[model samples]
Target: MHGGILGCASAAEAAGLWVMPFAGVHVWLTPTGHERAHDDCACVVHWSEALAFRRNRAVMTVPLALEQMAYCLGKEAFFVALESALHQHKISAEEISSLRALLPHGFDELFRLATVSAESGLESIMRYRLSLHGITVRGQISIPTVGRVDFVIDGWLIVEADGKGNHEGPEQRHRDHLRDAHAAALGYDTLRFDYALIMYDWPSVEAAILGRLRARAGRVVAG
Candidate 1:
């Protein structure tokens, strides 16, 4: 194959998409009929069993690419992608469900986490991590005095993940701070984490969330 057109990003980065991150003189298996690249990259080719499927359902095909992603990158990466695609309207939950039947082991759980409400890959990753711990999370929750918050846990805690582009500027940051304060005033404990903290330092972030959840439990026990 000369030109490859897979347009999904790496296994990490919260549903970040890319089309084969390898650059220049890339030597890899590209199946049978992948499109010739319009860019500057030399390539070598090898055959794969996945390419034997129908013209529309071959190795580089959307569903097979998703399946390859699942098996190659693992379940979490696949579902993160699934969430991003659903969120961006590149694919629907129904379409994802259809792919589920064709995928191998580990796909069922990924299908479970796939949804359209996830606004960003960061949110998707957070929600998925929380879910593995059995914590129920509600998306884009609206309170009486507060507008839509990112996610709500047990109706007692708010988890807001501010991506760089969304919450970096002074004016936007000021508004986010005010929202956190207002949410706290309304008896909701707010945990604000940024992209780096959530993505790179997940254990710390997870601990903070678990600590808050435990405190909420302790409050319940006391009352």
Candidate 2:
């Protein structure tokens, strides 16, 4: 039997690691020998053997938690957490290498996508999804008057991933409006997506981006 949190719950405790909203705590406990615990809506319990157990720590190590997270969060969410952890320096390269060795062969490409460039889970997910569509996204780009933008595509469109914590309230909204206005004046079109839109309604977001890109391409050809 193990005490304390493990897996996704442990990863969520780490700063900058974004996890999907879940109820109740995740704990590792002993089940009938070799049997894993059944997860319910309120709590998630793992009865499997821990990869590395530390007596002094209250939670699983960042690497172990991330390794366990793969099974619970699936590829997209797990990849987002991995990149966020890397960007926050919560996990090191050596630790990641060790973690990779323990994972199954199918996870190889997902692990390769981990990068420190994504400032948030939203950006990490967005960048990965866009890549799947063969879109080239340049992240964290700086335009002269616009300061630093989240991503730039086709050298004309700016994409911003807005998480709830950072982009909230009227004042912040006003600031964002000004930023978009300034960007537009410089001939850069801006598309700002909040957490819900990017996470849930992706088809619409993809259509908007692709439609804009296609329109821009048509205009350029006509010119």
Candidate 3:
């Protein structure tokens, strides 16, 4: 009973009074010369709908033998899209493995790093390399009258990567300074590199230590 100007256009096309939007489109027509758009498009029909209707009709009529492959697949429907998203975000290997372990059913072939323990000296070397240039470098250098120094490269460098429950309190600091002074007297340098430096800012820590080492080296070379 209700028909607007656009509705009349649709109705006229549907009722064979005029051509439908496409060759094979069968739009609904009422006997009273009215056309009814699909309920989904009742409120508004975009101009592009005509083009889409024609294209859809063309697609539906084509034989499997005649249709060519489509050029672009939707990203949401592609596995590579997911992989690209992961890589773009720099998802870590450990995180991927953890996710796979937690969600046992879904994903496959998670990334993982090789499992191996780093040696003590190797770890030290790694730190040393990270230190800035002109820092000291002393390997297995001792505290003279106390304990064996792990490393003392720069003249005042006293690097110690301590584990839990070691080197705590004023007494320890005093003793460390005393040892440091003794080493200084012996023309030694002291600078400490700790777990924090190793874990975070490792590069900057290495740069700093290297700087001190380079400066010490320069002094020795200059002398």
Candidate 2, residues 108-189: lDDT per residue as tens digits?
A: 8777666788887789888878877777788888898788999999899999999877889999999999999999999999
Task: Give Cα-based local distance difference scores for all models.
Answer: 0.65, 0.75, 0.38
TM-score of 2: 0.80
Point out where model 2 deviates above 4 Å. 1-4, 14-16, 30-41, 53-59, 218-223
Candidate 2, residue 183: how far the Cα is off, in Å: 2.0
Model 1 weakest lDDT span, ten residues long = 18-27
For model 2 the local lDDT of residue 151 reads: 93
Supply the global lDDT for candidate 2. 0.75
Q: How would the candidate models be sorted by TM-score, starting from the highest?
A: 2, 1, 3
Write the number of the candidate with greater TM-score, choosing between 1 and 3: 1
Candidate 3 per-residue lDDT, tens place, 113-223, comes to 111121232333343343323233444554657466755544456665543345578998788788777777776666655555555556675666556656766643211
Error of 1 at 172 (Å): 1.7
Candidate 1 residue 55 Cα shift, in angstroms, is: 5.2
Q: Assess candidate 1 and give its lDDT.
A: 0.65
Best by TM-score: 2
lDDT of 1 at 172: 88
2: Cα error in model 1, Å: 5.7
